[model samples]
Target chain A: MVALRRAAGEVGRSVAVHTRARPAQPQLHPNPWDTYHHTVIEPRRRLGLDAVRRGMERGEIRDDLDVELVGDLFTGPLLIRTVIRPGATLEPGLAERIVDTVLEGLRPRT
Target chain B: MVALRRAAGEVGRSVAVHTRARPAQPQLHPNPWDTYHHTVIEPRRRLGLDAVRRGMERGEIRDDLDVELVGDLFTGPLLIRTVIRPGATLEPGLAERIVDTVLEGLRPRT
Candidate 1:
């Protein structure tokens, strides 16, 4: 989980740089989407899904939860800060906070 | 809550259209950021924050949670499907699913 949080934070920071560096005319760029998908989204999604799967196996997460959607829950807000919401600060510990909050929610109700 | 769901869905659909219609040369367009901020981000953030505040008042959501971050969790995934992830379907009930999942995670653990 610590590694996952670190990877997520690193990805968020890199994405911040990537978004800023995007050419104003994306069509002139050599398939930015492909680069973004392969480099950012795919790896991050896989890592998050794996983490969630392991959590389920350990009985930390709800068995019935859709893992893909759970991945989105983890990825979305970070992406919003780094990609969509311009000028929003990608504060430190954000990744950890998000993970903790979602995990708290996902813990099976006693 | 129903109204919030409906509004979120509508906003998601409208954002789909808005993104698709954006001029490739955004610099040539008239202050696209301003338009996007005013039309989409600000209003949606306000609505989500208001709903979360009401939930807190009702003892539904964790009062300690940052309402803005909670709003980001709801908005980010929808934006991911509609705006960030090209070729991803903004399927019906996506808004409801996101809302429900986040709310489930958010419900005051008692």
Candidate 2:
């Protein structure tokens, strides 16, 4: 859970910084959304997925989990709160709460 | 799980249909993203959120869960798989898998 929180927090903070910096730059592309997806979104997603997979390999996560789907499960909320949802700010314990839910979901059932 | 799957499937299908029909119409505004978010995304999110809350009230979900955050958990994947992920197609059992993870997380732990 700590790793999950740290990884998510790092990505979220960087995205916030990037968006705040965007206004200073002139519109460089007719399709900025596509560029944003390829450059910003995709790499971050890959990094998060890698983190999750590493957890699984370390016997921390379930081996039966679908990597892509589970990757979305973690990445989706971070993206939504940080970008899609309006007026969303980095509240205290935000990453911790997300990681808690995920850990509870992904923890091996006894 | 069935309710979750049905709700997600309906929303995913409608979004797919709407996007397919978009290209034929001339671009009406410079910022269609905002319009799309308001018209399509927000209401769908509310509906999904309502379902989770209802589940909690009925003792199907954990009473202590955060409603808005849980709503994001349910709505996030549907949007990601259906809209954000490029070349993503609606796969069989996708909604079931997503709901299974959520239910496992949200179910009152013994």
Candidate 3:
């Protein structure tokens, strides 16, 4: 949970910084989507994947889990709020709530 | 689970249709984001919320679960793949997998 929280926090902070730096007008680029994926999505995805991997190593997560899908579950909702759907507020502790909910679901059952 | 599956399938089909109809170039609109929210996001979100409500009433989901967050967990991963992250493939049975995984976690414990 701590690793996941750190990963989520880092991604949230980076995205917040990026959102603030974005220009009002949409900029013309060869492929803004690709650029965004390379710059923001990929790195964050790696962070999430790493967190999930570590959790599995510690026997906190299920051994049979799909690592990528688990990562998406952790970050996708928060990402939608921050990037895709700007109207939704990133309330305090939203990331932690997301992490807790997903982890609770994903944790190994006795 | 049936209600949630129906809701998810409807949202996925509608999104597929919308994606096919979208122009190659980004269209000029006064508020495309708001338009999308009204036309797509809002309606789909409501469907997910309804599904969660129905699950609770049926005793399939926990009574204390946050409907909105649970809804997000069900749909957010698929949404990111289809709409936000276009490169990812929406493989067959992906929706069902997401639904089952989340439902397993959220279901009432005896």
Candidate 4:
């Protein structure tokens, strides 16, 4: 989880740089969707899905939950912060807050 | 909250329809980012920001959290499911799960 959040922070920083670099005509650059999928989502999907599968194997994550969905949940907020709410500062606690919310949802329910 | 979730479901359905109709070529259609902002984000932003303000005034939501940030949190997953993970079914429990997760995060922790 720590590593996953660190990756998320890195993704956020990369996106921030990309966004800042193109304030005038965002569309003139390569499609952000393509850039995001190639640069961020694919790699994170591998790492996050692997992590979730390991967690489930160790009885930390619920086995029934969709690993892909869990990956999306964990990364979605960071995506939103960078893409959806571009101007917002990447707060120090934002990654922890997002990771906790997702982990809480993914944890095996008692 | 019920109304907001209902609105989200509607947005999901609309996006699904849009996606299903455009299986041949997505970029040929209007920029989904524009469509999303105009058709979905703008209205939802208005309604959601209003709700968050009321929630904050009523002392249900913490004042410290950014209202726009909260709106993004509540809606980001749906956006992801529809736009980011377009093929995934809108699972019946998806909305509740997302809302519950956001509410848990927004709830004042002791």
Q: lDDT by residue for model 1 over B9-103, one digit each (tens)?
A: 56555555565565566555659867866886677567667866776676666777887787777777776665556667777787788777776
Best by TM-score: 3
| Model 2, span B5-94: residue lDDT tens | 577556545554454333322233426756776787677767777777777776666767788877666656655654456467667767
Each prediction's TM-score against the native?
0.79, 0.73, 0.79, 0.58
Stretches > 4 Å off in candidate 4: A1-4, A7-40, A54-64, A81-93, A100-110, B1-4, B7-40, B57-63, B105-110
Taken in order, the candidates have interface RMSDs of 4.9, 6.8, 5.8, 8.2
Task: Report per-candidate DockQ.
Answer: 0.41, 0.30, 0.34, 0.18
Ranked by TM-score, the better of candidates 1 and 2 is 1
lDDT of 4 by residue, B1-110 (tens): 56555654554444444434433422345476557546655665676667667766766556666676665565566655654454567777676676565555321223
After superposition, which runs of candidate 2 have C-alpha atoms over 4 Å from their true positions? A12-36, A106-110, B12-38, B106-110
Better of 2 and 3 by DockQ: 3
Worst 10 residues of 4 chain B by lDDT: B19-28
- Candidate number achieving the greatest lDDT relative to the actual structure: 1
TM-score for candidate 1: 0.79
Clashing pairs in 2: none
> Could you give the CAPRI-style class of model 2?
acceptable
lDDT tens per residue, model 3, A11-103? 645554465344333234537656775787678678768877877777766757688887777766666565445666777777788777765
Sort order, TM-score high to low: 3, 1, 2, 4
Q: How far out, in Å, is residue B85 in model 2? A: 2.6
- Winner of 1 and 2 under lDDT: 1
